[model samples]
Target chain A: MTGVATLIRQPWLWAWVGALVVWLATAVFTGGKGSGEVLSAAMTFGAFFVIVALGQMFVITLGPGNVDLSIPACMTLAGTVAMKSMDGASAMIPVGLLLALVIGAGVGTLNYSLIRLLRIPPIIATLSSSFIFQSAAIWWNRGLRVKPPEALADFTTAKIAGVPVIALFVVVLAILGHVLLTRTIYGRGVVAIGQNMRAAHLAGVKVERIRAATYIMCATLAGLCGYLLAAFSGGAALNMGEEYLLSSIAVVVIGGTSVAGGFANVPGLWGASLFLFLLVTMLNTFGAGAGVRLVLTGLIIIGVIVAASGGKART
Target chain B: MSGRLSPRLLRSLLPPLSLAALLIAIFWLQPRTMSYFGLNLLLNLAIPIALATIAQMFILCVNELDLSIGGFVSLVACITATWLHDTPLLGIAALAGLIAAYAALGALIHLRNLPSIVVTLGMSFVWLGLAVLVLPTPGGNAPEYIRTLMTLKPAYIPFPIIASVVIALVVHVGLMRSAHGTVLRGAGGNPRSLECAGWSLLKIKMGMFALAGFFGVLSGMALVGLTTSADANIALRYTLLSIAGVILGGGEFVGGRVSPIGAVIGAITLALAGSFLSFLRLNPDWQIGAQGAILIIVLALRVLIGRAEARK
Candidate 1:
């Protein structure tokens, strides 16, 4: 009983509760019809969100004022470049994937240089860089949508035992992410820097190197997500990554990660991602208009953030 | 001490210097822009941008960012073009309500210690939703009075210049010179001190948010007046533009340091950057990239100057 009580108090538990509650709400609303379908759909889409949010979580965990506003543009550029490189050729998939990762690394390097060398704030640096990336995407393909290769698309959309393959892959990835956050020196360094940069540096945490690695890791994951998302959706559009910007941040905050930095919640990422998808799915199922749906999303997000952050008192 | 003061002075001078340089380059490239008519053509759209920058500056002074400013401006524009044009009283009430809502949001954020970015991100959705609900298709008439006011040509100078000058002076006087403004800014610079000094942080935050809302309304109304119409997504870009404008004008993200006059100038400089690109005949596809490059170059210049300062 005590163990269960402690589990209930964990910050990550609320997101799971919220996800389950919304899922049940949707199930109840439809008289249990299509509930399985809704859950499957949530799993499929939620995987993409979890991928990006994972990167974002690491970035946010580094400290306040540290966020990657360029995720959307990076995704667009990567997806566009990768799709164009593959060009419906299964044989060129590895080359395209490598190219996407390279683009992500380059973007991350530029973003970090702007922050470190130019001494610009991270928010402004990433935001400005996004414009360049977005324009690059536009200039490269002129906003054209290119279809993914046959085998890649099939693998992305394929399911095993009613579970999406991508979702399963991401679940294993999340387990690895959990181990990386809690059981690694670099992870501890990130948390240390977030808690107190000066102390972290004094303790020989290699603050700059750790920060650099975290950012590069984040962008690399964003790259992989873009590649898979393009494949899953059958094509890559210019505006494909636009909605992920908000959703990525929303998932992090809603998952009960401390916005102030120094803390992380890996399990909560999955729950929050599913909850967000289901919330939208619930609204859509009820035949709510766009305006109403958006308003409710805003209000509900506010509610969740409030509830999640309620326990901790900050001066 | 004198050497340190020189660097501070130099930092203060960068915004105006850059604006002048850009202006001179544009005039030299397109000599016709030197005339009053050409100047109006170049700067007419800058009025709303300057207002939005000022709104952003107000929030920056309180050490908060308003990601919803773009959406808020879009909603205001929709209301101005639709209700304000057709039903004047109803429009006034709606605008007032929006400003009140902004103040309420500030109180909620301050009391709960919620991250402003998340709250405002959510509010951005709400504002966009409301704007879409109000103007589904983006066709509305600007109020007759607003249209006339926007287009009024004064003697000896263009209206945009006059309006921008008045705006800068008014905000400068209100926020930079007034005693109350100091207290408001102090809330951001050192809230604990202000709390110890027995000032209500909540009221200060509310005032700042309300001021931001007021300027956002002006930006939206001015934009609609100039364009003679409104759309749900009309000012979606203003959020970023305003932040860039504030930074260009030497506003720091966390500090309470901000310059109203410089912010307006920075806004004009950015607006002129678009014109400069067109004059240069840059490819339309690369214009956005060029804008980003310009932002990076300017900030890089700031860093170079700082390095010099540090060496000294």
Candidate 2:
């Protein structure tokens, strides 16, 4: 009884409930046929969202003014750079992955430098830097579509007994992320800083260092997501990362993470990712047109946020 | 203190000074642009951008951002081209309704304590969806009146220049010089104090959002007039561009520090930056990147000026 009560009290529980309800609604609409397949599809797609949202959740946890607007550009640039370098060679996969991560780290460092050194706000700094990164991606490949290595592509698409291999790996990644946030000193520092920057500073936490690390970690995960996304989608496109920008922030917000910063929920990230993916699937299943789909998506997101904010007022 | 420069004065002067510098560079690269016809052609598209920047400035004045302005403007353009051209009454009603919706959205955001970024993010999708429904494949004709009004040439000055000057002065007077405007701005700088003064924070928020919507409507109409048609995604970039223009024109993210004149000048400078890049024979792919570099450079200049002021 206590376990159930505690679970119900959790902020992340709403996201899970919403996801389950949507999934059931979608299944009922389809008369229960291919329901299993739909769940599988949700997991596969939601895995990618979870990866990106995990990073975004941390950034949002840092404070109100902190967010990474360069995520989509970072994804595009990393994917473009890695794919072009790999050139479908199986032996070069490791090198490509390393390059992607390095690019992410570099972009993150530059983003922080603009904020710290030039005194530009993080929002404007990241946004301006993203334009430059996007231009670089366009100039580098000239919009060429290069195929991923066969082995890598197969691994990305591979399924194991009705479960995607990528989905399982990402679940493990989320577990590790949970541990990092809940159990690590670095994570505590992040929470403290978010609650009150001056208080954290007085507490002897290294504010700038933690901030830089968080940004770097976020960008690195974005890079990893980009590399995998390129493989999963068969190639990198200039506009491929466009939708992810909104989806990432949406997941973080809908996952019950506080927008004001200092609090985060890893479990909620998963539920929100699945909910978002399934929401789209359900809307599409309804045979709704593009305009209606968009409007509904917007409305549903607002609804979820409003519902979840009820808990916020009490705390 | 005698020889020291006020940071406030420097901030006000920077926008026009940068605009002049950009114009000089553009003229130096392409001397023919100094002519009236050339100047007119070069700045013709800047009118919509200036309007959008002003719209964004309103939202920024409240210390809140509007991610939906680009989508809102796009929807308006779609309405202007299709309905406004065919049935003027329907289009006017629709535009007015959108402004009302904007006010309502402000009220919801304020009353619910919802984050503006998230709400506007969702609203952007709604606008895009509505725009697509209105014009699925992007073909809509602008009204005759709109086209003529946009293209009207005055005696000695380019029409765009005259329009920009008018826009800046009017906004400056309404937002900077008026008494009621102070209360509106105070809502951004210190809402709690404004509330303590017996003003309704809800009303201030609604007024700000409605004003943003008004300018956004103008921006869309102007864009369709200049382009002669409308597409759902035509003004999607305006969201980011408007935000950038506001910042470039000496507007801070926090605090109610914004300059209407500076914002207009910044919009023009950005519009000219594209032309300047093309004149330099730079790769078209790198043009956007160049704009980013320009933003950083200008901001870096601000930092240097700030440091100098501090030293004094």
Candidate 3:
């Protein structure tokens, strides 16, 4: 009983429980033609969003002025490069994936360099990088969009006994990320940096390198998510990455990760992602348009921040 | 301490001057395309954004952001177009009404102690929804008089540019020479300290927000004059661009100092930059990238100069 009570004291655990109840309630109310298809879509979207959100979570939880506005733009650039490079050849998938990872790391490094060397605040630096990446994507495509290869598309759409392959991919990435964040010295450094950068600096945490690595990790995951999303949709567009920016941030905050930094909850992020996806789906089913969704997302984010900040003050 | 102006202040003046130099260079280089008429065109373009930047500076000075200004502009424009269509007098009345409504919303958000970012963002949605609810498609035309006022050059100089200068001067005076301005700056620099000093933080914030809303309405009015029609997405970029302009003008997030004149100059610089890019027939994407890069550079320079001076 004492152990259970202790577990209940975890903020992320409570958040997960709340998110689960919301998701289940939403799923029950939105009865559809095929439960299997709905489940698969939900799982796929939820998983991918969580991965992207976790990338943001790392930056937000460890850095000052915590946030990255460039995640979506970076992802779009990665997907664009991957698709164009592969050019519908199954044999080139490995090359395409490697290119995507390289692009991600390159973007991360650029942002890190700009923020550290130029002393630009992270938000402004990332925002500028996002714009640069967006422009580059537009310039490279020259207004032309290429479709992904059939095999690569299959990687996203192919189901295992009615479960989405993308879901499995997201799960594997999440597990890897979870381990990396919990079991490694670098992961501990990230947590320490988040708790107190000055203290971590004193303890020999190579603050600059750790910050750069965090950005690289974030960009890589965002790139992977973009790649999968492009494959799932069969093609990409200039504005394709815009929607994910808010959703990614929203999931991270809703997952009980303090925007002010310190502590991470992987399970909580997953639950929040699931809840958000379900909520979006429900809103869509109810005939809500893009404007409504944007408003609701903005409100929820603001509400969460205000409530959390208020709670801290009260304590 | 001596009251002599610091070197940081001197360094801070560099961006606006450089931007002015750049604009002049562009004007000189493209004399054939950017003649006196082109200067007027540039002025007309700068007006809405300049006004929007002033509004953005108000919030930014208070260490907050207003992402809903675009939505507010759109809402104001749409309302003016629909209610004042074909009737110049009615359009003026409609513009005033909409501005009042938006100003109230800003005040209410401040009263609630809400973060301006989320509040304005939500309000932007509300504005969009209202726009869509009123006009599903973009069809309403602004009154001919208003359109003329927006587009017509006043004796070889654009009226909008002149209006922007006038507005900038007014805001400069209001902020620098008034007791209200001091309190607003105090609230922005350190709200807790101001409150401890027995000032009402909420009142100062509300006043600042109202001023921002008023500026947003002015931008909308200018926009209506320029486009001759109201579109929902017309002001979308202005939200962030205005913030970028303020920062580029050397306005810090935490208040105590603001340069309305600098912001106006920044607005002009940005307007010319966009015009130059378009003139070169460069991709719009490049313009976006350049704007972001320039803003980042300016911000970095501002921070570095400030830090260096502090060390000295």
What lDDT does candidate 1 reach at residue A124? 89
Tens-place lDDT per residue, model 2, A1-315, is: 999999888978888999999999999999998889989999999999998899888888999888888899899999999999999999999999999999999988998889889989878898889999999999987989999999999989999999999999999999999999999989888888889999999999999999889888888888889999999999889998898888999999999888889999899999999999898899999899999999998988888877777634312
Q: Is the docking of candidate 1 incorrect, acceptable, medium or high quality?
A: medium
Q: Candidate 2, B196: how far from true, in Å?
A: 0.6
Candidate that scores best on DockQ: 1
Models ranked on lDDT: 2, 1, 3
All models, RMSD in angstroms: 1.7, 1.5, 3.6
i-RMS, each model, one decimal: 1.4, 1.9, 3.7
Which of 1 and 3 is the better model by TM-score? 1
Off by over 4 Å in 2: A311-315, B1-5
lDDT of 2 by residue, B260-284 (tens): 9889998888888889899999998
Score every model by TM-score. 0.97, 0.98, 0.89
Candidate 2 C-alpha error for residue B134, in Å: 0.7
lDDT of 3 at B169: 86
The TM-score-based order of candidates, best leading, equals: 2, 1, 3
Find the 10 residues in a row with the least total lDDT in model 2 chain A: A306-315
Superposed by TM-score, candidate 2 places the C-alpha of residue B243 at a distance from the truth, in angstroms, of: 1.0
Cα deviation of A72, candidate 2, in Å: 0.7
Worst 10 residues of 1 chain A by lDDT: A306-315
